[model samples]
Target: MTRIVLLGGGVGGSMVSNQLARQLKPEILRGEVEITVINESDTHVYQPYFLYMAFDQAVPADAKRPERAVLNNQIKLVVGHAERVDREAKDVVMGDGAHIPYDYLVIATGSRPAPETVPGLVEGGHIFYTEEGALKLRDALAEFTGGRVLVTVGVPHKCPVAPVEFTLMVRDWLDTHGFESSEVLYTYPIGRLHSLEPVAAWATEIFDQRRIDSRTFFNVETVDSEKKTVTTLEGDTVSYDLLVAIPPHLGQDIVKRSGLGDAGNWIATDRHSLLMQGTDNIYVLGDATNLPISKAGSTAHFQADVVSSNLVNRIHGGLGSVRYDGKVFCFIEAGNDEATYVKFDYQHPPKPQPPTEMIHLYKLAFNKMYWLSAAGIL
Candidate 1:
């Protein structure tokens, strides 16, 4: 059996599993071939609409679909947390006392927020990084009348633009809720408003128009929820009534303990090919990889395409033939009625520019597409 083990059950993992199943032949991949995907969670989240568009508390039910629905029937999906990859033994250690061997291992374990890493954060402040966390905020947002609302990003967060997006959406929501006077602030690690140029221009302009206070170049050292204040590494403190903090992300604990990660515990990989260095027969993708692109779903979708093609070629005894372009598309809400999208393909030498409404429509309807795609209907 050609045993293949895929890690994680997120967007990136599900997409590649579907593609690879279509390529690896039944004769070669039948009983002789075993396809296993190890993931911890039972539900898969459509992360795009975690905020405004799908504001209903019940959205998580619709967002998560069965992992088996996304991949073909030939693949065997296992529900468990992988402790570490034993590259020397070609096996994966599960959180439980079990080991799964694999001919080729694909590490798709994604990133996670570490709010507790910040001083006084877990004990003092509130966050909306996960579904449950945001659900708590949903209740918090409803009962609260109005006060200083802060949306701060810790150093190195996935979906880097999300804090800004959430901030604007909440401001709009608050205004609708008759809290127009409530102070809204945006704090970031970067000097500019948005990390990307086109998006930054659009966001900076929105910051002025919507009155979203922008605080740049400040590193969040600790969050004091009880004191209702946030302290920075630069020894400055800011007060907040409600804090929507984006926590620093780290690679899956499995990869970190396996000694496959960098200083921050994110896995190191080829900048272009998405393959694990010093190890063949292994691939890393999305937020888990050391790719120099935004850790958004669009980036994962594009990376999966490249990894899928490359894995197929490698299986056929051909050379690694796929090259991944550092392409990313981000949709920004203009806060009134329209949205702005930005597209970037690193190969082109042109500077970043504002994207058209086509990207907006694409962004809005992505959840539906995601549901269809994840359900294997696509």
Candidate 2:
């Protein structure tokens, strides 16, 4: 029997397991293959919904579901933390001292915001990446009357356009709440509003129209909670009454501890094959990998298909022909009621698309489809 073990039961992990379960059904039913997924939490969170949850547009309860409920019954689920990967022995070291053996290993543990990299960031700024953070920010936003509102981005953050979306949403919220005196300012580490050229061009016009001050090349160095001040690496400083910061992101600690990560603590994999750089039996997906693409859920969704096909081919003693082309699709919210769509791949860059209420509706529909399909309820 082939023991296939998946680490991290997040979006990418769940999707890969679902596809693998279907592809290897014959072997699974005959007891020739066994699949197990290990995750730290018992609940699966719909992270994208957290944005709406912040504004009270979506309930918190609707954003989470039991992890087991979303997975196939045939796949074994283990609730534990992954300590390290023992590639030499083909085993996964669990936090509780158990070694889970595997013939094939899949690393899908995604990245998380690392606020520790910037001194005083966690103490001073409000971040909206998690449920608790978003909820806290919601209260902060409600209590805010009028002052400088700053939204700063840490480079290479997940969902590249999210900071821009948040800036737009906050502007609308201030306008609706009669806080016309409040000023909204945005800053990026790089020298552009967005990494994608076309999207940046579109965003420039939008920022101008909204009168949102955007400062580029302002890499954060430290934040002072006492004075509510942000200092950039080049010695530029900005003060704010309310600060929304996107902290630097890093991969799972286990990946780096296992010596499987690059200098930035991300798994180095072939951009096309999604296979670990130095190992044949190990594969990586989602934000954990050091791929030159946006670390969005859509990227993981597209990569899941490629990884699944490659795994099947390897299992059958054949080299996989399928390759990932760095495909990514994003829906950028203009405000509360309108959004824009951008699609691109390695061969092509994003082209500008006008924001529309219909695209916003499509985004709402996608949120529903994501939960339904992930739980196999649709």
Candidate 3:
């Protein structure tokens, strides 16, 4: 049997697992292939719902589901920590010392929030990347009456447009929930809303309208939790009653130790086929790749479609070089019951297209699609 082991059961991993289960026929699946996923968490998260944390739009109950429910039963589900991989030997090693052999490997390990890397962050403030973090932030948002609310962006983040959405959405929420007494501050190392110029320009206007104080090109250096102060590398300090932080993301140490990482320590995959540099049977997908696209769930869904087709082609020993356009079609919730949609790839991350109410509806609709999609019911 051709054993295929996938890692990290997040949005990217769950989507790919579901697609693989669907595309492989019964006959081929029985004798030719075996699929399994490795993950540390038992719950799958609808990360976009994290928007609710600041305004209480959604809760922990809204974003989580049993991880197994999001995957296909036909595939084995291994719940454990993946410590490393033996690419040449075709096996995965767990933290508990158990080794699972594989014919093909897909590294969808996803990303992790590293608050410790930022000085005084862990000791001073909280983050919202995980379930616990979200819950804590929810409480903090609800309890605080009003003060300077700083939502700082750490360098090298996932979903680059997220901070923009956070800025605008929080404005709408505070105004609705009577928390408009407080001001919001957005600080980032970069000078714009998005790296792409067109999108950045649009976001800049939004920030100004919301009355959000922003400092561009200001790299945050430390957080003095007791003083509720955020110190920038340039010696500027901003005080806050509640601080919402977006910390730098890093790959699982497994990739770095395996020597499969790139300059930023992300997995090095062939940009065209999504395969590892030195191995044909191994593949990497989602944010793990050093691909030039926003590390968004929609990006993973599109890449998974391409990777599944390309993997099947290679199984037949056909030299099919299926390339990804780095395509991404995601909804940007701009608040006021309005959202923007962008469909572009690495070649063009920004499409200065017009905005429409249709995008807002689609953003809401995506949540329903996601729950169904994750359950393999769509």
Candidate 4:
């Protein structure tokens, strides 16, 4: 039997497993193939909803579901923390010292925010990347009266446009709540509003029209929570009443412990083949890969299609010819119940459309429909 193991059960992992289970159902039933998914959690979370949850627009129950319900029945679900990947042995070592052997392996372990990496950020800034952080930020916003709202962005973070979305949303929130005296200030690490040239131009135009203040080339060096000030590496200090930050992200610890990742714990992957560098039977996808693309859910969904198709073809004794083109799609909230979207690939640059209410509604609809996507139904 050919044992195919998925090291993570996020959207990419789940979609790939379900796709294989359906396409290779005959082989699976005949006991000629086995598929397994190993995840650290029993529940899967739709992380995009965390932004909405910060404003009480969504609840925890809306973003979470049983992981078992998200995967195909033919796929085995193993819920435990992985200790490391023994590539030479072709097996994954569990925290309890169990070995799960595999003939083929897919690594979809996602990235995580590391707020503790920044000096004083954990105590000074509000991060909405996780459930607890969102709730805490919500409470802080509730008590806020009128003051400067600072939105600082860190590099290599998931959801590149999220900080921009939050800044726009909070600008509207202050207006709606009658906090007219409040100020909204956004800072980026690069010399522009966003990494993408077109996006930065669009966002800069919007910021000017909205009277929102912005600063570029502001690399955070440290934060003084007691003084409510953030110092930058360029020798500047900025003060804020409420600080919202997008913290730097790192891949799972297991990837680093296994020596499969770089200094940041992200695996060096072949951008086209979606395979680990110098490996034939192993694949990496989503935020786990050190690809120079936006770490968005849509990227994972697209990569999952390529990985699953290639794996299926290989199982049938055919050369896996499928290649990923770095496709990524994202919705940008433009406040006032309006949104815009961007779709681009390796060969094309995204041209964002004008913000509209219809696109905003579509984003909300997709949030609820994310489960279906994870099940490989759409």
Q: After superposition, how far is residue 32 of candidate 3 from its true place, in Å?
A: 2.0
Task: Looking at model 4, report the run of 10 residues with the lowest lDDT sum.
Answer: 172-181
Model 4 bad stretches (over 4 Å): none
Please provide, for model 1 over 258-354, each residue's C-alpha lDDT reduced to its tens digit, 9 standing for 90 to 100: 8888878777788678889877788888889877678877777788888878877776778876888888776765444446666677764224334
Candidate 4 lDDT (Cα, 0 to 1): 0.94
List TM-scores for all candidates, in order: 0.92, 0.97, 0.93, 0.99
Candidate 1: where are CA atoms >4 Å away?
28-32, 53-58, 348-361, 375-378
Q: How well does candidate 1 score on lDDT at residue 234?
A: 77
Tens-digit per-residue lDDT, 195-235, candidate 3? 76778777777778778778887777999989889899888
Task: Give the candidate number with the greatest lDDT.
Answer: 4
lDDT against the true structure, per candidate, is: 0.76, 0.88, 0.78, 0.94
Cα deviation of 199, candidate 1, in Å: 2.2
lDDT of 3: 0.78
Off by over 4 Å in 3: 262-264, 352-358, 375-378
**lDDT tens digits, residue span 225-266, model 4:** 999999999898999999999998999899989999998999
Clashing residue pairs in all predictions, respectively, total 3, 0, 0, 0
